[model samples]
Target: MEDSIRRFFARYEQFFLRALAGEPDPAEVAGLYAEEFIAASPAGVKAGKNDASLIEAMRQGHAQYRAIGTRDMRVRGLRLSPIDEMHCVAHVAWRATYLRADLPETVIDFEVHYLMQQRQDGPRVFGWISGDETAVLRRHGVL
Candidate 1:
């Protein structure tokens, strides 16, 4: 079961990488999301279960990037803390670098706390809260 969660997360990481690279397959991106997945980022609330809205969001985001890149997408820290087999939080550390046509090369760090939902079948990210303590640390290369 633990292995299952790990695999799901690995797949999620790959999906992000693919999206950043501007080659996300609609089906692959769709599969990781639940029918009512909601991710609250700095941008705003994005909620969708179907493919159209999600794909549109992805497309719009891709259009904004001259080059959006990611690296060190590691599970720097993870805990099944306050352990509930069905739900847990993940502390994911990642670096995102971007170079827009209008802007200079900017490397921003991110630490996202994903309120992940685990099922008997596998794990699916249900919701998220960004900009945590680790995010500040990562922004300055402190983590």
Candidate 2:
């Protein structure tokens, strides 16, 4: 069960990284998220009742950047506690080196908590909240 959970998160991370690098079509990436997906960050909250809106928002977010790249993306400390047979509360830490066209390379280290539920297809993210953005910005001298 733990292995399965890890695999699910690994796939999600791969898709997320690919999207961040502008590698996949938005529609394809949206398939990874559940219908009631929400992502919370330091900037604001984004939610989608359905896949279309979620995909559109993701596309817009990708478009907002002139150029963005990532290196050494990793997920650590992935621990899952069951809410039920089909759902779990997930806690994990993420670290990545971010490269943007206008700024020097910056390392982002954050922890994320997620509500994940299993679907007929697989496990999908229902919602997630991330922390440590301010620290990342300070590291880059943005703050």
Candidate 3:
């Protein structure tokens, strides 16, 4: 059971990284999220009642911040906690080096508590409660 869950999350992480890097492939992002997908970030919240809305929002988000490209993306770790039989909580950390046309490379490290629920269709992602420790890629030298 653990192995299956791990595989699912690993695949999802890869898809997310590709989307964040502006892959422009809707299926890459859409495949990971369930029919009722919800995402919460520091800036805003988006809920997808169906696959179409989720993909559209992802495209818009990438378009809005399309200037930056994500590099060195990795999943630091994942620990599944018991929320219930159907839902699990995952403590995860990730880091990305960002490059923008206007600004030089900057690295941001983020840790998020992901509350994940496995549904018959797929994973309904939510409960991203917090993130921390963002720093600039100083060695790269911002322009």
Candidate 4:
């Protein structure tokens, strides 16, 4: 189970790197989450579906990141707890690095919790909880 968790996160890292690039493959990014999922953040909880709207949202998100000079994102660490045979929770530590034309690189560290479903196809992120990302980004001058 631990090995499986590591493998899952490793794949997620690859997916993120590809999916959040300047020219992302939406289909490949969509594969990271379930068809229907929930996102909980400082703003609120929202039920979302993997559709064209979601794809466009992802694209816009990447655009924002690019605008902020974000060059890469990384999973710093992960802790997993099994909810059941077919479900689990993951606490993930993340870091995003940005570059500037006249300043040094900036790195921001944050954490997120994910509710995952273990399917025959693989692990799927059905829901995730996040902190006040906007404030953090703004404080870091990356917003």
* Per-model root-mean-square deviation over C-alphas: 5.1, 3.1, 4.1, 1.5
lDDT of 2 by residue, 19-133 (tens): 6666757665666567777778877897777556667776776554324445446786698888988888789877767665665777767778888888777777788888656
Number of the top candidate by lDDT?
4
Task: Put down candidate 1 lDDT per residue, 64-127, tens digits, no spaces.
Answer: 5423323323444444443486777776665656544544555665577676677766677777
| lDDT: the better of candidates 1 and 4 | 4
Instruction: Kindly list the per-residue Cα lDDT of model 3 for residues 1-143, writing each as its tens digit.
Output: 34556777787677666666667678766556555655576656756565677679778866654444555467777788877877887777766676767666776666777777777655656545663222243444431
At residue 33, give the lDDT of candidate 1: 60
| C-alpha RMSD in Å of predicted model 1 compared with the true structure | 5.1
Candidate 4 least-lDDT 10 residues = 14-23
Q: What would the TM-score be for candidate 1 when compared with the true structure? A: 0.67
lDDT (Cα, 0-100) at 75 in candidate 2: 85
Residue 3 of model 4: what lDDT?
Answer: 66
Model 1, stretches more than 4 Å misplaced?
41-47, 66-83, 99-105, 132-143
TM-score, one value per model: 0.67, 0.75, 0.69, 0.91
lDDT score of model 3? 0.63
Q: Pick the candidate with the highest TM-score.
A: 4
Clash pairs, model 2 backbone? none
